[model samples]
Target: MIKGDSLMFRGRLRGTALWGGSLLLAGCMLNIFLQAASLGMKFGAVADWVARYPALYLAGSLFLFFLLLLFAALVPGGYPGPLLAVAVVVLLGTADNRKLATTGEPLFPWDLMLLKNAGEMRHITRGMLSPLWIAIAAALIVLLLYGMRKLPKVRMRLTWRLLLGGVSAALAGGFLFVVGSGSSLASSLHYENLYWNQKVNYTQNGFLFAFAGNLHQNVMEKPDGYSREAILRIAAKYGGNGSEAANPAPTGGTQAEQDAKMPDILFMMDEAFFDPTRLPGYSFSADPLVFIHGAAKSSPSGYLLSPEFGGNTANVEFEALTGLSMYFLNDGSVPFQQRLVKMSSLPSIVSILKQRGYAALALHPFDDTFYNRNRVYPMLGFDRFTSEKDLPKAARMTPGGYISDLAAVQEAVRELRASKGPAFLHLVTMQNHFPFTSGKNGPNTIAVSGGKEAYRKELETYAQDTKLTDEALAELAKELKELPRRTVAVFWGDHLPALSAGIYAEAGWDAKPRLKHETKLMLLANFDIGAEGTGTLSPAFLGPEVFRRAGLAEPPFYQLLDRVKAELPGLSGSVRIGSGGNEIRKLTPEQEALLSDYRLVEYDLLEGKQYSAKLMF
Candidate 1:
C-alpha cells in the first residue's frame, strides 16, 4: 500500500509540472506572434529587438503571460482561456499593423471608439478583409477550439480559482496604472512615450506598453493662470465687447446697407485634396488642379497647415468652424467624439452667423451619423443639416460608391437658392476618400510614374478624383459669378490622402512634418475683395482671416486669433510657422506671451466656465 501511494503521488507531481511547462510555452508563443505582427512580420527585426533589449522583451512576455493566467483562472477549461487570450492578441496585433500601413498612424486606445461606427467604415476598409483572410481566421478559430477540447484539464476548487483571478487582475491593473500615469517606474524600465509621433513610439516601445500609455490622455487641461479675470484682461487687450473694429464698415454705409453687403458665405471643405505634383519623383500627364491653380493666382490663396495627415476630417472642420486649435487638445483625442458630445452648446462661426441673420446650413453627402455629426451639428447652431438620406436618389449616385463633389456642390447651390437671405453654407465633400483603388472611377486620365505599380495606381486614381473636384469648383465659380447677390467662398483641403508611406519616402515628402501636413487653400469671391494672400496659416486662423477678407465683423475671440496670427501664422501640435512663412524653431518672448494668451483663451472656452464666453463670443 505504501509503494502504490508513492507512485500515485509522483504521477500527480509530474502532471503539475507538465501543465506549468505548457503554460510557459504558450506564453512565449503568444509574445512571439504579437511582436511579429507589430513589426509587420519582420523576423530579423524581431531578433534584433530581442538581442538589443532582452530584459524588456522578457518583461513584455511575462506581462502577456500574466494576462493569459487571468483568463485561465476565470475559465473552467484549462486550454480555452489561453486560446481566447491568444485570439484577442492576434486580432489586435494584425489590426495595428494594417492601420499603421494604410493610414500612416498607429492604433491608439481612443481608436476603440471607432468600433461604434464599424458599419460606416466599410468604405475605408473595403478590401481589408478578403475571403482568404476570413477563411484563415475561421480555420484558426476552429483549430484552437478543437485543440482546447483535446488538452487535459486541471481540476481546482472554485475558491482557489477566484483567488488566482483576483491576484492576476490586481497585477495587470497595477501595471497599467503605473504605465498610464507616466510614472518614473515606467521610465526606469525604458518605456518611452512619444505623443507627437505614435508610430515610432509603438515601434521603439512594445505595442502593449505604448498603447497603455495613452489611456490617461487629458483631453484639455486648464492652462496656467487661467481665470475669469485673466480672460477679461485678454479680451480687453483685443477689444472689450467683441466689436467689429477689425472689419471696418465701408464708408457712408448704414447698418442695413452693411448687413445687405455681407455676402453669402460658403465653406467648401474638400476631402483629401492636395497637389500631388509637389511630391518629387512623380510626373503627371497634365496639371490635375488646373482650375484651382488658376484661381489661386488671382485670389487669396496659400497652403493651409492641417493638423491631421491621413484621416480625422472632423477635427479640421472643428478648427475652421470654432477657431480652436487642435494643438491645445491631447494628441489622438477626437473633440467631436470625446468633448463635443458632453456640451449642450458651444460658440462657433455658425452660431455667430446665425445671430447676424445668416441662415446656417451644414451639408455632407454621406451618412449623418459619421463622427456623430448628426447630433453635434445642432449644438454648433446649424439651422439645417443635410445628409445623403435627405438627397434624391439621382443626386446621390456616383461611380465609386461615394457622392461626387459635383453632386454635393449642386445640392449646396440648391440650398443657397432656397434660403430667404444671406446664408452660411458649410459643405463637406466626400469624393476623394480613402482606399483609392485603381479604376474606381473608370479609366484614370492622370498617369503617375515613379512609385511601385500599386502606389502608382493609387496616385493616378487620387489625382483623377481631385481633377473632378477641380472641374466641379470651376462650374461652381461660373454659377456664382452669374448670381445677382454677391458671395464669398472659402475652399480648402481637409487633409492629405492616405497613400503608402513608401511613396512619401521615395518622393522626399516625409523630410518635414510641414510638407506632410500642408494642403491647398483658396479664398474666392464673386465680387472683388483685396488681393491679400493668406500665406501659411492654420485652420484655426482661417475663420478670422475669412472675416477680415470679406469685411465682416470679427468677434473678440477672433480678434485674439488675429493677434496670435500676427506672431505665429501657422501652429500645429508638431510644427509652428512664423508670420514670414518660415518654420520657427524657437519662440521669441513676445511670441511666447501671445501663445500663452491663446492657450488660456482656448482653455477657458473649451473646458473652463462661461466666464470668457460672454466677453469673447
Candidate 2:
C-alpha cells in the first residue's frame, strides 16, 4: 500500500472515532439529564440546578458511562451502547413516575412482582397510560434507532473487542460495588447521610444511586446489643407466665380436662371496612355500619392501628397470626416474599391453637397465590387453606369482582360446623378490594357531599360495599348465636381504602402521614367470657387479646404481646396508640421505653438468633 493512501485512511478512521466518542458522551449526558429531570419534576421543579451538585452528577454519569461502554464492547456494530442506555433511563423514569402517582410511593424492586400479574390489574393500569409518557417514549425510540444507524462502525479485531468488553465489565462492577454497596464507596460518592425515606433520598441523589441505597436498605438492620442474653432478659421482663400458664377452662373441669367447653374461635378481616363516621363532618343516611356500632357496644371494639393502608393485606394477616410487627422491619419488604421462606415455626395463633388440639383452617375468597399465602399459610401452621380453587364458584358472590364478605362468613361457618372439635378458622374477606367500580352502586344510601365528581362517585361506591360488609358481619353473628356450641368472633379491617387525594382534602382532615392508618376492630362472643376490654388494639395484639378475653391461656410469645399491648394499645408503621387509646404521631420517652423492649424481642424472633424462641415461640 502507498504511504499517502495509508495516511489518508488513518486520518478518516481518527475522524470517525472522534465523532463516535462525541455522540456517546452526548447520549450519556442526555440520559443523565432526563433522569434528574424526571425525579425533580416529582417535587415540582426542573433539575437545572443539578449542575451545582457536580459530584452527584459525576457519580451518576460515570455509572451510566460504564454501562454504555460495556454495551458498546459486546455489540460489534456502531454505538448500540448509547442507544440502550437512553432506553434504560427512559424506562426507569417512566416506571418511577407511574408508581409514585398510583401508590404514593417510589418504585422499588419488590413492586416488580405486581407487573407479573398486570393482566389482573386492568383497573389500575387503564388510567396509567399517560400521553406525556407515550410522547417521551416515542421520542426516545426515534433517537435510539437514528443513533444506532447513523453512527460510524468501529473496525476492531475480535480479541481487542473482547478485551475491551472485559475491562468495561470490571469497571461497571467496581462502580456498582462502590455506589450500590452503601458503604465506603457510597460514602466517598457523597451518599453518607442516607435514610430509608425513599422520596427524600431519591430527590437528593438521582434515581440510580437512591435505588442502590434501597437495595442495601432491604437487608434488615440488627439492633445494637441484640443477642440471646438480651432477648431472654427482655422476654423474662414481659413474658408474664410460662406457656404452661392455664387459661380459663371451657365447660371442662380441670385445665388438663379437655371437653365441650373450648369455643370455636373465628377471625375475619373485612377488606376496607371502617366506620364512615370516622371521617370528619361525614354523615351517612341510616348509618350503614349501624349493626357494627351496636355490636361494638356489646363487645370489645375500637379502632385498630394497622401497619399498612389501602393494600398489603398479607402483612396485616402476618402480624395477627404470628404476632410480629412491620414497624421494625425494612419498609416495603413483604414478609411472604422475604421471611416466610426462612421461617420454620412462625409462632402463630394457628400454631397455638393446633397445640390445643384445634384444627387451624384458613379461608380466602381469592387465588391462593396472590400473596403466596397458599405456601405461607401452611408455614404459619394452618392445617388447611381453602382458596377459590377449593370453593364452588357458583356459590361465590363477587359484588365488585371480589368475593362478598357474606360468602366468606358462610364458608367459615360451614368449616366450623364440619370440625368435630374446636376450630381456629381465619377468614380474610375481600368484598371491598379497591377500584370500587364493580357491580351496581346499590341504592346509593350513603352520599359523599364534598369532593371532585369522580372522587365523590368512588366514595359512594366504597360506602355501599362497606355496608354490605357490615351486613355480612351481622349475619355471621346471628349464625354463631344459633350454634349449639359457644363461639368467639373477632372482626377487623385490614386497612383503609385508597381513596383519592381530593376526598381527603375535602374532608378537612389532618394531613399527617399516619392519619389514615387507623381501622375499626370488634370482638364478639356468643357466650359470656367475663367483661371484655374495649379500646384500640394493634393487629399483633389482636390474636393474643382474643385468647385473653376468651379466657384462653396464651403461649409465652403472646404473653409478652399482652404486656406490650397494655402499654401501647395500638401500634402501626406511622402511628402509636397510648393506653388511653389516643393516636399520637410521636412517641414520648416513656412510650419509647415500652416500645424499645418490644422491638428488641421482635428482632430476636424475626431477624436475630432464636434465643427467646424456646421461651416465647
Tell me how many residue pairs clash in candidate 1.
0
The RMSD of every model to the true structure, in order and in angstroms, is: 3.7, 4.1
lDDT per residue (tens digit) for residues 193-298 in model 2: 3544666666667666776656545435688777767776776775533344233234446543563556789999887777666676455565778788787666
TM of each candidate vs. truth: 0.88, 0.85
lDDT of each residue in 1-617, candidate 1, tens digit only: 99999999898789867876777777777767666667877888988877876665666777777788788898877668878887888787777877766666677776777777777776767766558668878998998888788988877689878987898888878878988888887788787777656676777777777788777665677778988889889888877564433234344566557557778899999998988889888889989999988888798889889999988899999999999999888667678877786788888888777777688999998889788889889989998999978875634324547888888888888888787777999999888887777766557998988868878888998888889889889988987887667788888899998877788888777778899889998887888887678898899998888888877878888988999999888899869999889999999999889888888988887788856666777
Clashes of each: 0, 1
TM-score of predicted structure 2: 0.85
Once superposed on the true structure, which residue ranges of model 2 sit more than 4 Å away at CA? Answer: 1-52, 68-91, 115-118, 121-165, 239-259, 281-286, 392-400, 438-445, 529-533, 583-590
lDDT per model vs. reference: 0.81, 0.71
